[model samples]
Structure formats: C-alpha cells, structure tokens
Target: MSRGARFTERLDLLWLGATVGVGLLGLRLIHMQVVRNQHYSELAERQRTQVIAQAAPRGRVYDRNGDIVATNQPAFSLIFLPGKAQDPARLAGLADSLARELHRDRGELFERLLEAAREETAIHLAENLPLKTMFKLSELKTLYPGVDLIVEARRHYPYGAFAGHLLGYMGKIDRRQWQRLKGKGYRVDSWVGRSGVESRYEDVLRGVDGEIRMEVDAQGRLRRRLDEVPWQVGGNVLLTIDSRIQRAVEEGLRASPSGTGAAVALDPRTGEVLALASTPDFDPNLLLLPEWDSEKQAVASLPEFNRAVQGTYAPGSTFKIIMDAALLQESVVRLDERVFCPGFFQVGNRAFKCWEKKGHKWVDFLASLAHSCDTYYYSMGLRMKGPTIERYEKLFGLGRKTGLDLPGERSGNVFGPEARKARKRGWYDGDTANLSIGQGELLATPIQMALVAATVANKGTLWKPRFVKRLERPGRPPEDILSEPVGRVDLRPEVWDKVQEAMVGVVKGGTGQRVNIPGLVVGGKTGTSQNNLGDDHAWFIAWAARPGEVPSLALAVLIQHGGHGSSAAGPVARKAIEAAFDLASAKGHEAPAEGAM
Candidate 1:
C-alpha cells in the first residue's frame, strides 16, 4: 500500500482500459464493414458510377408502297464525366478548346464545363453532333480527360418537309415530362415526339433501350460489355399515304397565292388516306439544328398549320350536299320538285342572298346542287331544322372527331340546340337558311369535307378515314399486330344515288369542272366558305370513280385566306387527281371506271 505499489496498480489499470478501448474499436469496425457494408457500398456506387442513358432509335415510317418517309440516322453527342476529371483547370481548357472548334462562346463553354465538373456526375456537352465533328473530338480525347464522344440515333425525315405535320417531330425532354416519366425510364436527354403522328404513336415508335454492365478502373474506362442486354429498335409504321399524290397536292397548294392550305385524299372503299398535305410545313431537321433564325423563318414561311385535318371553315354552298341528302332521306324535298329563286330569300327579319344574285328562275335539286342555288337550299334547310340537320351532320362525321391516329385532332364546332343555347343565339329561320347553304355557324375541317365526299362517292356507306395502315414491331411476333378496321355507315340507296349523281354533275357542269381529270370520272363539290374573321377559306371535296371502284380515292383541299374554292382549292385537287390517275396508269391498274362529266 506504499507509493510504488500505488503507481504499479495505476499502470495496470491504464493498460486494461487501453485494451478495452481497442476491443471496442475492433467490434465497431466489424459492425460497420459487415452489417452496414451494403449501405455504404451503395452510397459509394451512387457517387462513383453514373448510369448514362443511351437513346434507342425511333422506328422508320413508310408509305403505302413501302417508300421510306421517316427514318433514323446516326448522330454523335459530346458527353462529360465529372467523376473522371482530376483538375478543374484541365476541364476548363478542354471546354474552351471544344468551344473554339465548335464555334461556341468560350464563356458559355467554361460555365458548362464548371457545371459538369460539379457533382452532377453526367452532363451533355453537345448533342446531335455531326459524325465528322465527333471523330475529330475523339482524336483530341487525350486533350480532354472527362469529355467523350457518344454515338446516338436521331430522327430523320427522308422527304425533308414533305408531310411534316402528319409525320411530326421530336424534341428534348423538358422538366415536366422528365418528372412525369423519370421512373418510367425517360431521361432528360431523351427526345419525345411533340406533335402529329410522332406524338400519337410515341409509345410504339420509342424503342426499348439495351444495357451493358462493364467493369471499369478508378479512371472510369470500360473494360468489356458484361452480360449485355440488347436494345430493341422501334417499330415501323406503314401509312396509307401515296407519296406521289401527296407531292402533287403539296406542289399545287404551294403554287397558290394563299401559302397556307391542307389537302387530304382518302380511299372510299377502305377509308385509306391516299394523300394528306399541309402547307407551310417546317423541316424536322431544322428543328433539331442550332440555327434558331432559320428555324423561325422556315416555320413562319409555311402556314405550319394542317388545314386538311385542323383547318375549320364554313362549308358555304357545299352544305347543300348534306341538306340535299337529308332532304332526300326525310322525303322533305322531292328530287325533281322545282323551287323558284328570285336571287334572294327572306327568312324572319333577315334576307339571305344566294351566290347567284341574278337568280335562276326555277331549279330542281340536281340543278340546284350543280349551280349551288342558295335560295333553293335555304328553303329546304328551314324544313329540315335543328335535330334533323344535326343528325345528318353527325352521320357525315361533322362536329365530332374523325378518330384519326394523329394527335391534336379537333372535334370541330357543330352547334346543337344546347350549343346554340349556350352561345345565347336563338335558332331562327334565317339561321336555317344560312345553315342550308353551309354559311351560318357551320364549320367543317377539310377532312370532314373529304368524309362527306366519300359518303357521297360510296353511295350511302361512310367509311372511317385512316392514315396509318399498319405498325410493324421489331423482333415481336406478328400475332401481336394492331390493325384498325374499316368502319361504315349505312344510308338509303336512293338517297345515295341521287346525291352521287348531283356530286358528279357538280364536277361535270357545276363549279368543280376545273378539277376533272382526263380518263377519270371525278365527282366533286366546290365551297367558298365566308370567314368574316379573315379572307374566305377555299375548299374542294371530291372522289374519283363510281361506287363500285374497289380502291376509290376521296379528297378534300382547303386554302387559307383564299378568295374562292374553284380558283384556289380546285386546281390543287386537279393536280392530285391527275397524279393518282398517272400512278394507276403506270402500275397497269385499270383506271377508275370512266363516267361522263
């Protein structure tokens, strides 16, 4: 119990305390390395490894005859890996060099490089780089530690701006879309179809991405594709469109003074859209480029509006076709019964003037439709009022969606009793008169007009118009194919014959004479719808051959701000019809049965 004995005891206690501390530290290390190993490993993996998305090539789109309209081409992209870089200055220098080579501002490149050097992990330096530029960048890879060249697939339209609206375009994924599609495998760099068929068939056209697990060193260089899973290419789309006829329609539309217009041609038998053209089309390639001024100008120059499916115009005299059909169906107006036209007719407090201010003294239904006698139909529309006309309009696919596969399809404005009431406008006799001639409150898209034409051409049956013929998926079984059926609407035979004959006469002796193609029986109706909002919309709806033709083609043309249907739209329709006939002749297919005009 002396001082020496006390010192030795203290040393023993200190040694024991030290041993206990070391044992505790060893147990803690085991717990962290073993029990919590996965958590830390995951955190390390998250920090060191980044999953960069590789975009799958979108499917190619083809025409009816297997002509390629839309396809994918190889693109080079510049990517930056922040984790691979050591010095920020080196990264900045590399970015500056790239900026100089690509003709970009050095400050912008420096800012981007600084951002990329952060913990963001993956950053895109540039996208859709040309192959030559990408190869040059690859050669200079040693100068840029983190920068790398990536081969990507980009959407390409073979026909440039042709059928652009129908084909649509793709754009980079935005914040909203990214948030919505993040877990669903969509990445920020992913391109999505923003409009038209591209938007509508996005799911079908977006191919599945493949993945490869590669072993990399601390420097992050790939060793091999470990257990690689191949990606699936997008499906192929076969359109019902005839490129030849589509080109002709586009050329004719472009030739007109009104640069904005749309033309849709369909097969009466199958409701296949032969040609769908929209004027003022912007090239999809331009949208993908860096030239903003060129892009704006290109879009501005063309109407960029799809007039055929989206352009809504007053039917004008063309509504006579519907009225005539409804009258014949209801037996309200006899086909041979004569109605006197004194240039204008008085309905309620309004006196609606006919197209021919100098009236035809007396005219029957056939002559009325041929001459587009407004007074005759104005009287008839009064008899067939409200629900009666609405029924016919619905049957003709007006005021409703055509269910076309393309996106942004409008149901069009068809004012019913409720709609009229909502608008606070009472349905007056004058309204009926105007409606009879397709003027008052009646608006129809060019596609709707084409449908009406098809109904008349097919006698009584109305077929649902379709643009997409078939979808071909890669590596998938054919049994999984999706095919839309040909829809038909039934009508009385007599009603069909009388309407058909009148439509035929419209082309032969009436306003559509300009559209008559040689060696082909063309039945058509011309419409100059009044647009007080702007210049009148010119329209022409027609179909080739009689009811019996198996592949009967129907068409409708709309000219924006064009003065008259005959002058603006008729010539476009004529060119398209001529092209179709020429195609038939070239293929040795029998020309549509010739019917005298």
Candidate 2:
C-alpha cells in the first residue's frame, strides 16, 4: 500500500467514528426530551406556577326583627410573587415603603414579610389592608417586583360591643385547623369563629368559595381573567333575639354596681331566647385587625366571659321551686299542707337557720315561697329524699346543657347518687337540707335557670332553648329551623296555680318586692346564694304575667358578687321586663298583659 492510500484510509475511519459518536448523542437527547418530558415539565411548573386560595365571606347575622347584627366588609391585602423578585434587598425596601405609606411600622412589616417568605412560595405582606393602599400598591407594581395586591372579606359587627359574647369573634386559622381544613381547601389566611353563635353556626356561616382562571404574562402579571366563577355569599341567619330587649338588658346591667353578670330572657311558649347579655364585652371589630395583642389583653382583663351560659352559681332560694315541683310530683306535700317554722330547723345535731330568725308559726306552700323560709323547705326536703329531689331537678332541666344554637354552653352541676360518689361524697340529711334551698353542692348556669323558669311558666312542657330562628340565602327561599325538644312533664293545673301565686307573692310582698312594677303581673323568685370562696351571687328567676297570658317572657338574672337577689338581681329583671314590653309597644304590638307583684 502506498503512503497516500494509508492516509486516506485513516481519514475515512476517523470520519466514521465521529459520525457514530454524533448519532449516539442525538439518541440520548431524544430519550431525555420526549420520553421524560412530563416529569421535567411538572418540576418546572411547580417552581413557576402556584395555586392560591381565596376565602369566602362569612354569613350575615340578624335579629328576629330583621336587624343586621353581624356581616362582612371588603378588605385589601399585599401579596408577594417570588417568581418575579430578583433580590431580598429589593423585597425589604418595597415592604418598608409600603408600610410607611400605610402608617404602619416598617420593621414590623419587614419581619412579617420575611416570616411569610420562609414558608410560602409567595408571601402575603399584609392582610385586610385599606382599599386606598391596595390601589396604590397595584399602580406601583413596576417599582416593586413580585409584590401584588389581594382583596379579601373581613368580619364586621356594626353594633359594636352590644352583643359581643352572643355574636362572638373570628380569629386566624391555626395549625391544627389548617390541617383539618386543608382537604376542604381552607388556607392559612382564613379566619374562623372561636366562640358563641359564630362558632356554633360556622358551617352555615362559611360560604362556598369560587375560582378564577386567568392568563398571565412572562412578568408574572395577570393579563386578563379567562373564566370567572363568582363566590357564593353565606346564608343570612335570623335569630330569635330581639335587639331592643338585648340593648335594654345591657343598659340595665351597665347601670348596676356589679361589674360582671349575665341575663337571659326567653319566651316560654316557644323557648326562644329574646335577650342574652354578658357584661364587660369586647368590640368584635378589634378581632378584624391584624395586630390583636392589645385588644386580646383588654378582653382578657375585663369580665368579658359569657356568664349567661357559662357561669355556674348556687341557686339559693330558687331551689325551693324545684323542691316544690318534686313534692308535687311525688305527692309528698299537698299544695294546702301547712308546715310550722320557728326560724330554725334541727337536722340531727346541726341547726339550719332560716332567712327569718323569727319565722311565721304556720306557713303553707305559697307563704313559704314568698318568705323564702328555709325552715319550711328544710322540712319538705327531709320527706322528699335525695333521689326524688334529683328526679325533679333533671325533669326541670337542671344541671344540663340547654342545647341552644350558641356555643360555649356548659352543663351545670346536679349531684345524683353516682355524681355524689364520683365527687367522693355521700348524700346526707344536711346535704338534703342545703339542697332544698338551692345551695351547697348545687350549681346552675343562667340559661339553665331561665329554662327552669320557663318550665314552670308553661305548667310542665319543656322546650329546648333556641337562638336561630331561620336561615336564608341571598335570592333563595327562607328555611325555618328548630332545636330538638328534650321531653315534657305533666303537672296538675292546681299545682301550677299554687306555685304561680307564691311566685307572684315574691314580688308583691316577699323579698323580691323591690322588683315590683306597677300594673305588671310579675311572678318571680329571689335567691341569695352564699359563696364560701367569694362574695355571694345574687339570682332572680321570673315569668311575666300569669300562665294564662301565655308567658310572654321568662327571664333569669345573675349578678356576680352581688349581695341580694331582691336588691341586685331583681331590679335588673324589672328593667329588662319593662324594656321588653316597651319594645313590643314600639313595634305597634299590643301592650303585654300587665299585672302587680
């Protein structure tokens, strides 16, 4: 072979090797781009595109008379799009400038931005921002890359602190709630009701959120909305509460010297709560703001607790009514039976003293209730026994949840045989004596007491107390709703008559005389429950007019640390009843049946 031939052959082999290498490289590229394209595309989409959720507006709450109590208002928020920002310094500068424009602390705003950035692909600068600031930020989006504006709905209460406890307040969605609601599409930015009616009706109040499909530009800005689905606003909640009566209860409670207490007024015929008031309430608007430390501290410091359904206190003389019911139920004591009282009764070695040291020589059931004679009830308690008393207590809805639509209701304490054993105590004669007068181990919430009053007013039927009357959606028909009834007891009409007479005497000539309203037939019981650990709790339970009047109103009032039911609690009831009647008259309704003490 010649030298020229050898060189040509070597060049041909080199060309063939280069062509084979190029063919292998092209095959590898095809495998990566086409065969694994979906996996890579998903990875890229995760980095560049994010799914954000929008919250739905909470439902509106209204009084029975169609007055708005709670609603939602439009709010603005500042958001960050990480895909558009190039540097942290620029992000910090934009946040600081925005904070200054909003009259907020720049440092705080910067800290929040950094914190949000750490967890979210795009951080929210501020939630519920003012509309003007949102518009300003939107216009200056060019100066602040990755920063955007979001509009939201915030809960608003127009009545201020009037029915704060009953209406409750919403708070930020916590970690546990976020996890629970994540599957349901709830975001961290969502707010939920934490107490009262708001918490109880959360499902109905939280409306369905909608969606928007939008096309964006390369700069991560929304060019236009392609398809939009409007969000469904929550239903309207109509409560049985009367705002006028509620305001009157608040005013009367505020006028009292006692700083804390609760009052609940109900309609005996339907078991509908007319007015529920808890003193030292906080403004619901405070919860709508972002920084709630100061407002939370203020609420914590005040006696803002909902005492009407939460506070448990001894019943004092009011237990006598329960005793009366038990005696009638058991046939242990007749309505006309007379018991002798000498101001004190001896139970074994212990001498139980009555309210009147020198009691009336002979007292019937009516007179006993009027004078709140401890001796008379003590004698009856000895005959009735613990089991019988407990039976009547349960029947009257004592020591149980009222099942009202509002949240945070407590089951008050009633000591049955099993309960007594659990508490490491044994039933005794003295315990029975104390129990007869509604003291010792017995405790009840204001709503519980109000139910008891209603039970007696209705002669024997017990209606489950209810707050919400109807639920209606915008542009939809209203749906009437009701709570499940517990059961009913049938007491003789004669027994109700006797009990009614005694209760009426309580206001006319007995300890509750101070609460007497002229021309108003007010049947009531006064209770001064002694508290060994603190000041006595004053209590008054009453039903306006007679049973024949269909019990237009039934009420229970409790004044924490208030001395006497006659002086402290009774006046509050009187004022509440008067206001309720006045409210009815103002609405062009006939004057409620009037009666004297």
**Predicted model with the maximum lDDT:** 2
Q: What lDDT, from 0 to 1, does candidate 2 have?
A: 0.78
Q: State in Å the error of residue 132, model 2.
A: 9.2
Q: How would you encode candidate 2's per-residue C-alpha lDDT over 1-597 as one tens digit per residue?
A: 999999999999999999999999998899889987898896565445544456788889999998999998888777665543345686578667877676677887777666644543555566776566567777657886556776777788998887888888888889999999878767766788888778778777888776654444434455555666677778778899999889878877777668678999999888999999988678878766655245644565555468898889888888788888777767898777998999799999999988777776799888888878888888999998878887788888887888886667789899655569887888888888888888887899999999888888888878888888998876678889875567786787877877777888877877777656665688899898788878788889999863346678899998888877777787678778887776232222222211111
Local error of candidate 2 at residue 449 (angstroms): 0.8
Clashes of 2: 3
In model 1, pairs of residues that clash are 280-302, 280-303
Mark the regions of model 2 whose C-alpha exceeds 4 Å error after superposition. Answer: 1-54, 83-85, 95-123, 130-143, 148-151, 211-227, 292-297, 300-304, 334-337, 358-361, 416-418, 421-424, 473-477, 546-548, 583-597
Worst 10 residues of 2 by lDDT: 588-597
Worst 10-residue lDDT window for candidate 1 reads 588-597
lDDT tens per residue, model 1, 218-258: 44444344555667788887888899998998898889868
| TM-score on alpha carbons, each prediction | 0.86, 0.84
User: How many steric clashes does model 1 contain?
Assistant: 2
